[model samples]
Target chain A: MTAVESSVATLDPEEARRLRRERLERIGSWVLPLAIMVLAIWLWDRICVWNEIPQYILPRPGVVLQTLYNDAALLFGSLLVTLRITFLGLLLAVVGGVGLAVLFAQSKWVEMSFFPFAIVLQVTPIVAIFPLINIYVDNQTAKLLLCAWIVAFFPILSNTTLGLNSVDRNLRDLFRLNGATRWQELWHLRLPAAMPYFLGGLKIAGGLSLIGAVVAEFVAGASGQSSGLASRIIEAGYRLNAPRLFAALILISLAGIVIFLVLSLVSHLILRRWHESALKQER
Target chain B: MVPSTTVPGMEGSGKPLLSLRAVGKTFSNGVTALSNVDMTIREGDFLSLLGPSGCGKSTALRIIAGLTAPTTGTLDWSRKPGEESSVGFVFQEPTLLPWASVFDNVWLPLRLKGVSRSDAAPAVSQLLERVHLSGFENAVPRELSGGMKMRVSIARALVTKPRVLLMDEPFAALDEITRFKLNNDLLELWQDERFTVVFVTHSVFESVFLSNRIVVMAARPGRVFQEVEVDAPYPRDEAFRTSPAYAALCRQASDVLVSAINSTHGAAA
Candidate 1:
């Protein structure tokens, strides 16, 4: 038996071939998507050049890139403002959502009484609320943060509630058998069980928070140093600076992509070792 | 091997550790899980509640562990006051905390009892070794196979050194080979620890091999139908698994379980 095992373990030719194929497949997964994106952009640039499109109507990709490079200081500074609002909104949403979720998990009555308000906040358009918020609030940053918070709050609350409630029944029984107090059970079992769901909700909220920040900024339309990327887009539209408009739009989309990737990476890093959703498929 | 007998509560010469008299459980949905179940679990005895699905064996175990209160019965624990906390339960599934390591999982009960990690480490390590999982302290539940996870669950249950251990079909999900191995290891553990165990299983061979006393239960408002004692001596090993006495006891228990299952069908018909 030992002789047969040693022979099999000595790096067989079939094993080498399989390993090479696996490596190629791993690289191809990422490279293929990037290649397709580059081809699409190239096609867009060619269509504009061939049609003799004016800069105001449809700027060439090079024009848009040049506009981005020239306006880097202004656009990038606005991006920082937008990103600050996005991150602040996301952080506040997490705290409020998880705090309320724990309260709801602790008492069904509290959930029944207050969960409707959350739904109302979710369904009511942030644009509609912004007028009321703008009229009432004195601070501009606070108004934008509130709008972003409203948009990003519900998924975290609902998903976390579901997660806290979805604990295994047998595990609960075991906890009860072991004489675990209410706080102990919540701290030890429910919180950890809710982490994956919380992270999932975090991914959705991350994108929404950025949207909220941009949309709120657009609604505000406050000019000067405090204006964000959305305000820049509005300014460019009014001036008919098409390339600048495209540049600002590109920055916003890039910001959204970065937020999504970062949140996904965080979720994967935390859950990779244990969670079924994050674990790699064996075959 | 000791001879077979029909002694219900007189097998071992000691006061009953726990007694359930006329115990019955009815859920809020009006489903009767158990009815008029009477049993006495003595200290240091390996007991198996043998039945078909929905036979209320698990319900009985739950009631014994005080996890679920019986709707219409009383349970008397022979132990003095404050000793009721020394009860351990193993569920059908492993019911492990997937996020915790094997060591942390085993340390849970002690941790809940306010034992610090450093204080509980030795007991946790000792229990893991007894379950043949000494090297798997830091391994998470997701990394272990079904049998190995069950071993960790058993280790967690035994870590507290409970006076009574209630197991509800702990090995029913395992394959035949794993089940046999766990059964043997469990008996060895029981012999070493001398903790009273109330094991629930549907396998007659398993019940006969691991339990000295088996309570046959019937379904459709499940209740105990009969009691069969295998009068088998302790230190039962693989040799006992192949012995004539083991075969006879298994045949007896199987006949009893078959009749119990048939009676449920007959009543339904």
Candidate 2:
């Protein structure tokens, strides 16, 4: 505290003012959002009270919280199922995306011959392909996982391909000058350069994978013990259990938020020291 | 120093470290980047290829560095039997890997040659020390200022201890003060290491300041125009930069460069 005080005291008036602004910004970034959320939640409760809405139609936030507590085992288990598919799908996408991107980086013929297929797959909606998957894949879990992978794969493939192609010209020449082999060039030059791009895709893919899982389960309509939160939401909707439906939805959104945060953290940890995207914000 | 009295074109140094014999390059687009760029670089010679922008000095350097192939003629290197074909090249920009640390960047050549990081540490550290980047081994390229990045690049280039060090206007982007400081440090390293240098640039003052021999090149087919020797003794400093002898040499080189530029301009017109 003394060290900070001494530094502040040493700063000029303008510098002190700037320092104060920085402190305020740091605190406000967290506190402001929380305050607004509290206000919004209060407003929601007031509307529920004023409308005198019944529990089935528009359950109060308190009732939803109680239902979440009451249905913890069911809701949490369903979230785990959804999260498992999302993660497995993302893992497959990374391996396939990066592997194929490397192939594309190496040979124009390979890329030219098959890149259109990837484009077509990306452009074709997963919903449109659901019927096809259902026909071929008898396993419900595999079907949902495949749908998630398809949704998540394109961003990783395209971003990684772009990054691989964008290797610095001079650095490439340097690698060539040093007699680096094809494998060495890919491992040392292309992969590290593609990391930021790959991570960017990962962040987008994280959320998309969750959405894919939920949407796929909804489309599949396979209800059972192993069914994900999407099935629970559908079941609660059928029973007119608005609080339970809200609880299931809240679980899915929370799971999505956790996945995004984890992916973002992974990106930050990998690139914090070097990448421009992860560098300390001067502003 | 090769006594500053050696003839520009006369043969029989027996071991001209590298000699370009009628080198020419024509791109697929039909732009003749270089033609008949004949020159011989001797051991420990600070030779500069000086001219205007389109003069193909960089192309000639690249050809010598074996980055680009010459469509016509040969680059002959008279290496000793045990010597590997090696040359260090510095690009116009500080092309250190943005993702790699200063030490790792310097360790690259050794790493490419199959040396492990721990094994190459001694050489990397020694070169980093030579370039005054000793404490900055862990810093990435983005963390460095432009001049410092250029310094790291020089260290990386020299880490392999190549027989020839080829620089393509390595300090062109730096401010004048930083450029001068780097010039001094480079000369110090040259004096210490005694490696042959082939520096390419358009600035006559810089060329004259650094090189004992400056080969002025012409554009529009980029060929050698003239060769001017500095005839100045080493241990050159600010005293030398302000001296009448240096002024005369700069004037002579500048006149040659202006003539080369005008000739290219006339051809283009």
True lDDT of residue B102, candidate 2: 91
lDDT of 2 by residue, A10-58 (tens): 9999987998999999999999999999998888889999989888998
TM-score for each of the candidates: 0.93, 0.94
**lDDT (Cα, 0-100) at A184 in candidate 2:** 92
DockQ for all candidate structures vs. native: 0.77, 0.74
Question: Residue A152 deviation, candidate 1, in Å?
Answer: 0.7
Encode model 1's per-residue lDDT on A191-224: one tens digit a residue. 9999999999999999999999999999997544
Segments in model 1 whose C-alpha atoms lie over 4 Å from true places: A1-24, A222-226, B1-13, B265-269
For all the models shown, what interface RMSD does each have?
0.7, 0.9
